[model samples]
Target: MTSPRKVRRVVSLVPSLTEAVAVGAPGLLVGATDWCVHPAGLDVVRIGGTKNPDVAAIAALRPDLVIANEEENRAPDLAALRAAGLDVMVTEVRSLDQAFAELERVLLAGCGLTAPPRWLDDARAAWAAPPSAPYPPRTAVVPVWRRPWMVLGSDTFAGDLLARLGVRNVYADHPERYPRVPVAELRASGADLVVLPDEPYRFTADDGPEAFPGLPAALVDGRFLTWYGPSLAGAPAALRAALRRAGPVPSPRRP
Candidate 1:
């Protein structure tokens, strides 16, 4: 385990982890995936997408550590990096608590930091309490993709985030983490709202809301909904505002 002091160079495959690492220690990152777009003017060697990183290019960088996610990066890619003698720190974040803990582990334990970053504390403070509601929590279907129609299902970080925000993911109890369901099934899933994010699919107000004719659709920032980094600090407020502005759902049409 290379200590944080010894970790002068890093290659990050995960976008969220990229932002987290870059924000925590600027200039420590020498390589990152093309999707690792945060901290705005980040200048690093692009290693391709999360699923298809150039292992040879990464190995050539001779990074002290490569940060990845269990769900984001393929095992074979991580193995190839390890085979090239690169140390890989893989993180698993399924829920809010796990996200915080895993982040601390990556920064403090993996990066060997003296203390957790201030943004981590800010994220914690931002989501300290569940949203106060006047009515029962709204039931929603959170779609990550459209063509195949996969949705956020069971024990996911995004689902947990929505739960904390007083929105219940209708498919949270489904067997799969991201289940592919037909558009008609999703529309008839008895959801009170359709939470559409702008990435992984880029669902806009005009693009996504039409599918669920009578249901309110909240077009949210994908970074807030999916990315678990410095953005976590503002995610709660941002998501809540989007939900509040969702407007009313029209009455369901009779068959």
Candidate 2:
């Protein structure tokens, strides 16, 4: 393992990891994927998208360490970077607790920092317990994409995030992590609410709500629901507010 001083130049392939390292130690990041949009006005070389990063470009930067995530990046891409002799650190964040632990590893252990940033502490405190809601847990379907209609299934970080906010994903028991079910099936799943996010598919009031005529749909910030980084600090409040506005659902409209 290289010393802290030796790990100065870093490249981040994952958006959340990029934001974590950038917020923790901005000067350390030399190159990052185009999708690393957090910490707005970040002035790093664009390496490409998370799925298709410019390996040669990243190699050209000669970074001391390249950060990645198991789900956000492709295995072959990480392998290719390693094949070129670049040190790549991959993180796995399946749950909120895992996210906190991995953030510490990346920023402190990987970035060679003595301690985690204050936002990490703030994030931990923000989601320490489930939010106090007046109504009972609402069954919801969180769609990440529209084409072929993929929804959040069992064991997803987003599912756990919503669960913490008192919203239960109807498909949380599905065998697949992200299952592609037809729109008809999703509408008939008995979900009282549909939580739409503005990412991975960019669902909006005009775009996604019409699918379920009478079901209450909550349009939320995808960053808070999906991204696990400094944003986690405000996620609890933001998500609670969105769910609050969803109010109650009406009877399902007959075809």
Candidate 3:
């Protein structure tokens, strides 16, 4: 009988996946970026940032498998790695559902076996039914990056996640992907919540309530709220927790 091939020694180029594997399946993570948190003090070698990994440094790790995300990585780097004869698998997650599936796929492929995190079911349930009574639908704005000010457009994971939360998207009106808008426009939104993600851009209360004063501001964890993967299972609940912290959506109540 032929022996089974060993699939050990992994290099994770995706920030969310790197954190997931480090928590879901540790020890095997031979390389990750400085942004890869979770698992506390993971000594895995540093490659580079999520968008642009130091391919040479990663190659030195001699990883049998390299896990990266299509959304987080660039084409040129991937092409370069392919030309170098390195085995790299990329996962592109446009929605929350896709994120969960991809995380499971990566874990199974890299670790041979893995258990779905407990948060998965909880997130699903939370999304299906929030704690609030009659969970009134709300319009909201999800900003991923600033300066130019990128927002979560229709059909994206951020949009879907908000939909799951029983909130209607304000930018659903726009057709462009991650379109930029003026702050003055944001101040005039019909949205009840101005979701300020911790990443892509870090917005603080000091930034001024006038920026989003009329609407209640929600400070959410960008990783959980945006990154879909094994991490997704926990996100809905994290969102719920954030919502709870922010309290029930008030004002502009429907008649």
Candidate 4:
């Protein structure tokens, strides 16, 4: 049974959410998943990975709340947590707007914070206006994985972020959120660039860029591209730096 009093303890299963709570209320989290890598020196009990958390260990922590993401966590796992009498807060963030709203919901309501965090405000401000330097509109193919080769499709937070950066995803109209496409199809997508992030599959400068030799591959921080947390504050500048380094951005400013 969940306590009606103040939430004194928390266990986060989502990496982004763990960072958000860890930053908002230090020491509030007694337990977090192995993937919760933000707030650098976070010292907490490691439950397990996002997809495969140790439910027994998490319950043993006796947390006031357990945070999870709809996309990153499985339904049965969430169900198991709830069945174990844990107060689970599952979040869904498919766009930048949703991120801010969900963050507020999770931090203020779920964790019982008095108000919103400064980083949330800073993140909002960072994306308040599109950058002054606008490149000619470009299209991109964002591969989250290789081998089987899954890419971001429609209604995704990262795709929305890229769109805000003025880069349209070629697969934005696909029916599935994350779809698998053949390497040949991805190569022939005619996108101006390939935006690759360094998580889910760890695409690096050497590893990912070689896949799309014909297109300029921008190896980006997956945390910035995907995670909606403290990293969001500097994502615009960080991503801009990476994207600018990619061939298509500019040799000289339009000014």
TM-score of each model, paired residue for residue: 0.94, 0.95, 0.86, 0.94
In order, what lDDT does every prediction score? Answer: 0.89, 0.90, 0.73, 0.89
Worst 10 residues of 2 by lDDT: 129-138
Give per-residue CA lDDT, model 3, range 159-199, as digits (tens): 77877777677897688868888877876776677777787
lDDT per residue (tens digit) for residues 6-55 in model 1: 67889999999899988987778999999988978899999899999999
Segments of candidate 2 deviating more than 4 angstroms:
1-5, 249-255
Q: How close is candidate 2 to the true structure, as a TM-score?
A: 0.95
What pairs collide in candidate 1?
A: none
Rank ordering of all candidates by lDDT, starting from the highest:
2, 4, 1, 3
CA error at residue 185 for candidate 1, angstroms: 1.2
Q: What's the CA error at residue 64 for candidate 1, in Å?
A: 0.5
lDDT of 2 by residue, 1-255 (tens): 555545889999988888888898879999998999988999999989999999999999999999999999999999999999999999998899999999999988888898789999999999996577535789999999997899999989999988887888999999999999999999999999999999989999899999988788899999999999999999998988888888865655689
lDDT of 3: 0.73
Better of 1 and 2 by TM-score: 2
Q: Using alpha carbons, what is the TM-score of model 1? A: 0.94
The lDDT leader among the candidates is: 2
- List residue ranges in candidate 1 displaced over 4 A: 1-5, 133-135, 248-255
